[model samples]
Target: MNKPSSCVRRALSLRPCAFAVLSLAAACAAHAEQPMQPLLLAQNARMPSLQDMVVTATRTEQPLSDLVADISIVDRETIEHSGATGVADLLARLPGVEITRNGGIGNATSMYLRGAETRFTAVYIDGVRVDSQSTGGAQWEQIPLAQIERIEVLRGPAAAVYGSDAIGGVIQLFTRKGEGAAAPYVGVGLGSQGTRKLEAGISGAIGADKALDYSLGLAHARSDGFDTKTSGAHNPDRDGYRSTSGNARLGYQINARHKLDATLLASRMNSGYDAFTYKPASPVDDRNLHRLHTAGLTWAAQWTEAYSTRVSVTDSASCYETTPSLYRTETSLRGYVWQNEYRLGAHRFSAALERREDRLDNPALTASGLAINQGRSQDALALGYGYSAGGHTVQVNLRHDDDSEFGGKGTGSVAYGYAIAPAWRVTASLGTAFRAPTLYQRFSEYGLPTLRPESGRNAELGLRYAEGRSTFSAVVYRNRVSNLIVFSAPGGCPSTFGCYASTARAQYEGLTLAASQQWAGVQWHGSIDIQNPRDLDTGKQLRRRAKHHATFGADTQVAGWTLGAEVQASGRRFENETNTQVLGGYTLVNLYASTRLARDYTLLARIDNLGDKAYELARTYATPGRTFYVGLKWAPQ
Candidate 1:
């Protein structure tokens, strides 16, 4: 008899872990024998109510409890108190999410949603889509976390509502909006490794009727970082980064029926990294320069008591350049969407027409010294229907996209949720999604013109219980992809070394268990993910992804201060797709505290990797150890 493939063995081993987590969740539910009641929160409580509205699930506002999608929300309060280094750093604490950075906060970064490739998950900032046609994903390192006010993570296929590149999930980031009285704030921070930061912002309404509101913010941060490369082959010099970012939001209410809003965010970053061209004797410092811009204009009109319409125009530009190595790429994305929503009793309907254009400019990619510029456009029409009444909820979506390169693609999804009890709910969903190949993958030196788009089919089941300060959720999902793109030996392209091809299939199957409860004056939350992401043809695990990863944390308010501690752990992972290089598993502990220093002054301190554990997110990369930051902010009461 033939031996079982490695992928099969890995999948088999993860079954026990997944079952254990499910059993735990069941046991927790059984323990809740008492009657559940509505949540009543103190003014200082941090636990978010399940009734909070979220938009990323269906591209429309829906109460969290009324939806069937697996999602997570991070508000500005959490962001300000966490003292995270970047957007990816903050999102790494969420369920079914993982991140890897080549070096520091300013270096190359990748975020995986349920073990999917970065490109499979679409990202948006203030409703503006941001992506790189050259790299096939958003530049995670370029996103400014300080300017973001809220984040929504939807962990499932939603191509029917979002168009292409929603195979894994979608992430939406929102900036601050203005309302109420004029408010202003300023902050300064000092941290280990010669880190310093300064930030300021103000928001308020100005008109007599408060019909106009605005917000503006600016931040500057610099860090003298440690050596990023541990390998002796590169230069042994300290790497550092400098960043400047700003954001503005303005809104006008044209009477009671119409409103207009505009948002803009810009950021620039310069960081140092050791390149392959480093020489021991006469090493030259390499610099990575990044500039990012996102802007959007939205108009909403209430046509009737039960109907509304919204139109938005968005544009984003991302540019990356490396000095001394002479590589530069720029991606510009423009989007236009007109969405209509209608509500009648317990039924909701939505229709949207969307258009997206992507342009890629690579001065380095030239045939005869002239720069190469390539672009593509996609036009789509989408429709959605939702019904929620009593204990049953249903949602259906369909979309058809006409691509300039790929002709036509259609996607759809259906989701249903049933309330088994006052505090318990079960959900199931099935969806189809797709992602087009990057322009660089089809036109670069190592490109293949015949490559097809990657398509995915996803199915999931979830059970959730929420009542008062206690919440528990368990989700099981499997996403299978065909025509998976990977670089292979030269044959189809001009490059003799290698070329991209759609020659493989892959599967991402995972069980995610998450829970939160307030017990003994402490608020506790945790999540664990047991997944098997493997290439179907080779039967090997995907690179840089683990089979088991988990996070646990607790927060408590004591003596007018909030204190929190967290632990992050991961199992061993393969450094390469071939599974030849093994990266060891590790654990990290982090602590944070915040308190009001005065009536108008608040202070916060955070310590990450408290034990100075040595771990690697990627091969030959050194992770930060025992980093600390302290900040003080002042705002008028």
Candidate 2:
């Protein structure tokens, strides 16, 4: 009899998982068997900063619970406990956020916020906007999770504050920073799908006065994934991927009123896959190379106790190369902004001016070996005001954008909130937003130069309650989108090449509810989302969007160990607007545990897809099956 296959051997290798579980349980029992001193000691110690400040909701730092907009915050503690390696995993858990991908990791990804298209959603890192000019989507896979300290999401129109690409709302990422002293850490792990990963980082304050600070992170991962296509006629070879990313930041506090900072982030990826082509095409290997980089600089000063100003600059680029086919593309963006704010009595006012340019290089293989490039630029101005007095707050903003190719457009928003009681509040908001046509959508082959900007309106009413260790929030919104771009071969256009047109409309209405509580020694959090997205032309549901979804998770510490479980479920989605192809709904359950090994070291393990259930996040794509990962981490004290 031959030896068991490699996959079989790995499956049987879960003996370590069993061992870890037993060890964790034994350690917990031993601690539980003792007095509850540790728990009491932890509770007595001043809690880790419960008052979290966020700026994404309104471009100003304010208490998370006090913001009038619908917002979600993914703190560092939550990110660490979720046992997620990919940013997509973390995003899928948020309320009203949806994702779709071509395959597994390293593949093209898409995100929909409040049922809006990916391009309409804006992404920012350290106040710098980043996106591919051609596709208008952020390179989510290239962002290393280990380098991020937190993420904030706003789920409504934000064009009045940030200009274009804010029709769906905004997401901001903050990088890690050095604390009091130097701290360094490292980690390594292995799991299913032949996956391997390594990460290391260090952060510290420098100089006698500790006025200078620096932080850096490095990460690399590789995985041999299963066939991308689960059904239909396609290649069966295993697809594999490799990725490396790095992020670094430097800061200097010149004085009590002046400060300067710089940040850089870069990433590279190589992926292999099988292509399904009927006509004559390259029979050789199919692969792609992807690279993304961003850099930013800022100088801020406080002229007086109530007046301040800032100036910033940012640059970002995204590049892609395809093998065999010899296709390559590069998109770059440069931005500059000047902002000022003044505080008077019980009101604050702000003004900003911004200029941004986009460039793309996609040369055609002409007879003469020549290349052609395309570019566009835009200028925008914004004004905002806020007032807070006696448990009541109100905010409003207005902006105007002028593009070189599309002329000019204006947008505005207003929000009001009142506290019913010390622990309860009610809020209402109305906003307008727009998405400009991408270069590919307006000037490429079969593109329409006469296309107009897609515009929309958002109206929301919300209720929130917070008391002791329990908190809950609910929001209901209605959105109307007009001048949607679509492709059709009208009259003079040839059937081989359809032309783009803008006359369509859409409506999206949704409700989101979320809650969290901590009692005794256990903590739990959950969210539910119900939405209806429809195309006004055909009165049909949007393709690849579920009408309902929910998530629940809980964790507790027993003795010297902590254990947790999570569940995520989504309703069925149609592959086409006509609703012929039905992609079934799915539910996934996961388990994770952690325990301290020594003074400065710890052990972590997780079992994903605990029951080995099969599911689909996208049509014809194969999602991960039963898998697990075990790792050890160490940090300097």
Listed per model in order, the count of residue pairs whose N, CA or C atoms clash below 3 Å is 0, 0
Minimal lDDT window, size 10, model 2: 6-15
lDDT of 1 by residue, 1-637 (tens): 1111111111001223655466446534543554444321111113235677889998888887767888887877788777886899888888888888888878999999999999999999999999988888899988998899988889999999999899999999999898899899999999999999999999999886999999999999999998999886786777888888899999999989999999999888888898987878887888888888898999999999999999999998888888766778888889999999999999999999999998887775344333448999999999999999999999999999999999999999999999999878899999999999998898887888778999999999998887666667889999999999998998977788889999889999998888776668876677789899999988999999989888778788899999888888888888898999988888888998999989999999999899999889989998888999999999988
What TM-score number comes out for model 1? 0.94
Q: Lowest-scoring 10 consecutive residues by lDDT in candidate 1? A: 4-13
Q: List the residue pairs that clash in candidate 1.
A: none
The C-alpha stretches of model 1 lying farther than 4 A from their native spots are 1-48, 365-371
Model 1 scores a C-alpha lDDT of 0.85
Give lDDT tens digits, candidate 2, residues 1-637: 1111111111000011334223322322222222211110011111112256778876767665445787777766566655576676778788788888777777777888888888888888878787776676686765667667778888999999988889888989888777569889897888888888888999889886788998998988888877777766556667677878888888898998898889888777777655554123324456657777778898888999989888899888777666645656677888899888898987889899999898877665534333337788889999999887788888899999999888898999999999898656799999999988777666656566688999999999997755555556678998899998777675332225577777889888888766655546675656667888889889888888888776667778887888878777788888887888887877778888888889898788889889898877778888778889887778866
